[model samples]
Target: MLVTAFAANKTPPPSPTTTVNHPETRQIHLKPINRRRILTSLAATITPFFAPRLEVNYEESNLVTATFLPSADARGLFQMPPPRLSNRYFLVRAGESEYESMGIINTNPVAKTSMDNGLSKIGKIQTVKAALKLKEMGACDNNCWIWPSITQRAYQAAEIIAAINVVNRSNVVPEYSFLDARGLGAYEGRPLQSVSEIYASDVVSQNVKPPPISDGTPNESVADVFVRVTQLMSILETQYSEDTVIIVSPDSDNLTILQAGLVGLDLRRHSELYFEPGEVRYFDPSSIPKYKQPASALYKCLNPPSCT
Candidate 1:
């Protein structure tokens, strides 16, 4: 009964009959760089001029010289043991010049101790693996879902630029809309579909009887839904200069709620935007896990409790 009441009282869904018209183009202005000033300010052979100013401090260097010596049998006869061996031996030169003599030394237990404690090749590999895993996990923040769209657009633009490969262009034209959706129909003059209409018509129309009033509170208001749609549209526009057209059709009462919300957000006069409801996608927010804290926070709470 709740579902029926909500649906019946809801605003008429958006019209999906419309198709995308000619793509709109808006010019973004940018200030041209002053090449003359740049050339005048540029230094010719700047490195050469500053080369004398730079001083190399060879006197203060604390470089350590390591010399390898032949092991017993002198023909690679001994198997090199693991670094943990306290008395591990290696060949080294006894003195500084060509006059250096071959001598066996205990290798100063402290020196061997330092070399033993250094990261092993396996340890280095493990460190790299851990770093990569952390980076992958770090990308999944609250905005993770939005990244796919952003990345796709970026890749497409890159491809276009690479394909053209022209120089001295006055402006770079962007030729893709990232806000296109599958299914649903158009409202107003725009030719894109919305989620609400798709959900109501496809899902709600299936039941012969009206849905009962739900005991559970609605996850979001129609206006809230509209706002989210608009916000997503604005985000796309700001990021990629793409426009989003939303269409919703609701019953008179429910329409009032939607219109009020739209007016509150000052999007009522935007002709490119629409509100018709016959076709829209219905996303059930409840299906997704909603955590009080972000994924990072959750990780911190579990792994490094002190980080919080």
Candidate 2:
């Protein structure tokens, strides 16, 4: 009865009289089941999935319990852990570009390199004034670096700054992409007045990306640019200490966004901290008000899905 019940679960066997498929179908050999080994195999497979999870939870509890600050209870109160900046940062907005004088937006790399679209004559004068201002402030009295966007206008400004500040050409490092102007996506080459639409979207959320271009130019969100800027900050903090860094940008957006992050302002409102062409500001982290730190928590990402 037991054998009949066990065999009932498998495919029906051919009758003893049936010889048609006997030569065609090959018999599969069956090994006797080892209950202990099977159980051991399952334990090996399943234990790992839960064991590490349990171990991670235990470790995280010990690591984060005393250190983690919940945002809910800390409302309206200033929190510590300010941005770790070991260098003096002088944020400079490069002088007006030829495109700006023409009332156009030209963020395309090829066009930016062209003299027709690069810095205007007026821009060169503005850059010289900004550079002279830096020299007057004694910004490069100690070790200093002149960092600029790869855009021709910014590079021009950086050269002027290096000359005025007596910094070496090697120290005038041109940032290839991160410090470049915020690409306006499909709005590229459009009238400068069209930028209001981009800022309108930015006022709503930092994650809003501009419409993508057909030429494979990426439309970046404020968050995307923020990530790049954050990476740049990390690199600068790690590589240099107690040095002066002059960060030059082709447009106001990059400098404003960087200032917003450094001062703990909501990134969505970065446009509020605008930088005019040829504007120069010395970034001092210690000067940030306590109110800015506490207000940052209002937009804090505490829970999942609601974070972005």
Candidate 3:
């Protein structure tokens, strides 16, 4: 009678497991808990996406004077408008230098140019490997240009890259303060770790310009660096197209910040894009993550297709 009553009950039995069968194959059983575990595992593996942060400062802003702009859509872009670029761009952080090996910080324009502060032996080898990689990638198959910082280590790396690739020696143009390492003010000649304080502040505000020295050394903020890098980008995008351009920097900060600006990232968090010494990254505008289109006032159009 008890079994008869159980059978008459309308309640359905809970499924302990479900069997999935492949045609002419073995049947695999999956428990409900197993399904939940699989879903949880997938969720753990997936990385959550974060929207680009825009922190604008009108005081440091300047107008972009270029007449021609690249055709890229500028919606949601910050610092500068979406660049119209036909040229392939590469960012190369200079190889380790003598000063770097010694754990010294040197951004003084005069002192950094000295030969002793130039690329160490390992640095030269690293630069040569990078050039070979570029050759393998056929980056210099056409007109290639290497724009390097005036700092000796970066210039040396540029020369090495030029020698190994198809680019001519003359094409290795030396850029001035624009590509220089971030200035650490009184922290100059201090230990490399001392600059962490400045970066900590940069995380708080992009407008935090470092105090200046009496000797005329640069004491700049991340925004100050952005201003110069934006100017450089204006020139490059305006003058070159259908060419390969390699920009070499003596330190990671310049290239990282430049990349941050290039991708319309918040300049204050530029350190998130830091490059290892001798690291090389190819820049592609189409591959960047997109955000909701922002108003044109969000950025200064460095080189706009139409400023209207």
Candidate 4:
């Protein structure tokens, strides 16, 4: 009786059935992205990523700076270079170590390779001494490339030209690397007051593109953004033996991108570092450990739906 009751309560199997799929299904297409006129639009962030093989010195010259500063060389209220020029040549792609340094100072417009901001003579002497001292400490090695930010090529040319003079006068100095400033051909433009802002607005804040301007402003170009991020990453991933310094602009987007990459904030919220114009800042990779995920650098989640 119990067995019969259990069988009666059990579920029954139904007869065979046929299923059908729609013949006219819809296909989804993603709208095209307008790459140009976007602020801080790094190459990797946009389409057509960089070449697989990034030569260490594409437009770079060998350069050096110090790992640590001697009290005398570490002068200045904030130990900053003057308002315009980090003229010394330094390696673009360094390594991720405490001993390696990526110095960022400043760059300004120049009419020729031998010009500077002409803003400060005292600043030149101080930076010259500091850059050389860094070379001894194993930073740029005295042969570094003057950074060519869109707005500061001329300024960089002036600073490195000044540093080259110091390398010549000093008792022991590496020959200024890469004889030319790579032609300050692309330095004429309006300044980008906040490179960091562009990234934050577009990548982080989900904002509109800046209005296209033809005037001399640093109209964010895809190639230029790619160059800055790649050069800085090369320094972080492969080059350098210690903490690095950068003679950079107070508000450079390139510098901000470097800082963001280092801190592993791409997938969370965009992070940035703020330095006063001509202010000196020590960038230690140790401060922000590398991301555990090997591809975080490439993934660089700039616009995660939930990322800050």
Candidate 5:
């Protein structure tokens, strides 16, 4: 029976013409998965070897740091000292062209004390001092024909004159004619009365130089001096017509006018108006005699001043 069963199982082998399909022989297909997830997993498996550990300190440490120190002359509460008359000279010169084009006249009206005081207070501050320093440093020369300091001062003076003129025309202030001391001349091609004559005729003093008083004296405060100067400037304004522009030559004369506080002027107003000394090819370095050359590298190393 066993031999017969074996022979029967063997007889089940298929002939060459007959074929049977097997499930294992059929083609198989796979479903797609997220490529990003696979790549992330692969990267995570290899990253630990390439990364480095970093250490940070939480406690404060004493570290010596070297810093450059500026020289003693370079360090001061005021970058530059208060402006003197010399500074205004350049300011007026720079504004001359504009004054001519605008037909600004040098009108000399008597200025009230309050008006003078208001303007003088603005001039004493450090900002004005810094402006004066810049003025001293810029320009082609002390006599810069193009953008002189006197031009800038004249510009400021013109504005004040314009304002006062408007006030007078509107009848806000009494219309009063002071003497014109400018002498008869053509200013910017216009025939005008002299500034000197204006000062001489209407006002008791025509170009009368104020008597020199001792400096640093208690008899009159600097503020009082400013008031007097402003008054003179106002008087000058009243004497000239709106068509005439006062041309103050050279920066020194302009500064003298400013020092007198006659124009309701401030240096800061003209700081950017004119070329500075450094900008100028030539300037009077003697104007600021205190400024000196920096010490040599070796000298500075040997003689450092105390900072504290």
Candidate 6:
């Protein structure tokens, strides 16, 4: 019953959860700017789905980020439908931005350095959590492919698949990449000199535009990211059709693709998906007619479930 996707002859109920929201805080002046970056695009895009004559600001709406609204991602599916849920690709956003202090550039120097201090500690902890979640969600330990961005932050991904196959040790092999740079130039890895050069909001106070993220070329937009991700899924279906490929990538890169994907699908709602520290998501090919598939919400460490 816990894993079922549909209700009995009626619309499924809205999400019910026990997590509590902390009191809203404006303690940091920089906070609102982060919300504005993505929400602005969402609001403007949603207007087209409403009555043809509707208008919206998208900049300041609380409802723009309704996570538990089961139909939240539905509206996005109407315009550009999500890709078929291929069994081979399991997209994952690596644990929290633990490297916020390291300034985002994964140049040769940084790449050679291991994640240090608290980020290293938290990164491993989150990887283990995600490992446990994926197994419980029906993933088999053998023949898994761990794909991660060719950045230092991706060290967490190696640890993740390792945790997934603790007993066998050789169950999965990891491959790091910059989006298949040689052939797939459709989207390129960000080449930032410093973290400040990465996102518009990252250096908003500087009053400068974000430089081209790829060899000084124009940075890819959210829509571009979505297209590239879908393309990768298709390629993997051909390459690893019999195995699973779990992706580990950055937040903005992965989330932007997801947020844009929800809009492309166009179901019925306009909301930002919530991805927290140690978050893991699963999409099963078996769940065809995916617009109706429920979001994975199985939580652990509550009351223990007895072993069979």
Indicate the TM-score of model 1: 0.15
TM-scores for candidates 1 onward, in order: 0.15, 0.68, 0.67, 0.35, 0.19, 0.45
Model 6, residue 2: displacement in angstroms? 65
Task: Go through the candidates in order and give each one's C-alpha lDDT.
Answer: 0.25, 0.74, 0.74, 0.34, 0.28, 0.44
Which ranges of candidate 6 are over 4 A from the true structure?
Answer: 1-83, 86-89, 101-119, 141-143, 167-218, 255-263, 266-271, 284-308
Ranking by lDDT: 2, 3, 6, 4, 5, 1
**Candidate 4 Cα RMSD after full superposition onto the native fold (Å):** 24.8
* TM-score head-to-head 3 vs 4, winner: 3
Q: Candidate 6, residues 1-308: lDDT per residue as tens digits?
A: 12223323454444552222334521111122345656787898774555333344577764553233223345233223334543545556556443443433332223322453123566667767777877776555565766655544554555665566553345344444333111212122333333223333321221222334434333433334445565655455546656776676644345434433433421111113434545676644344232332354321112111000
What local lDDT does model 2 show for residue 51?
Answer: 34
Residue lDDT tens for model 2, 65-117 = 22333443433221212336678899999998988999887776656567765
Candidate 3 — which residues are off by over 4 angstroms? 1-79, 286-308
Error of 5 at 159 (Å): 15
Candidate 5 per-residue lDDT, tens place, 1-308, comes to 00111222244323222233436543222223557867897899866544443233435546543333333324322111223222222232222222223433321222111222122223223223423443445431222222211223322333343232332322212212111112112221232233333223212312233232233112222233234334434443444333222222222222332332322222212111233211112223244223222364311211111000
Q: Is candidate 2 or candidate 5 better by lDDT?
A: 2
- Order of the predicted models by TM-score, top scorer first: 2, 3, 6, 4, 5, 1
Model 5 / residue 246 / CA error / Å: 20
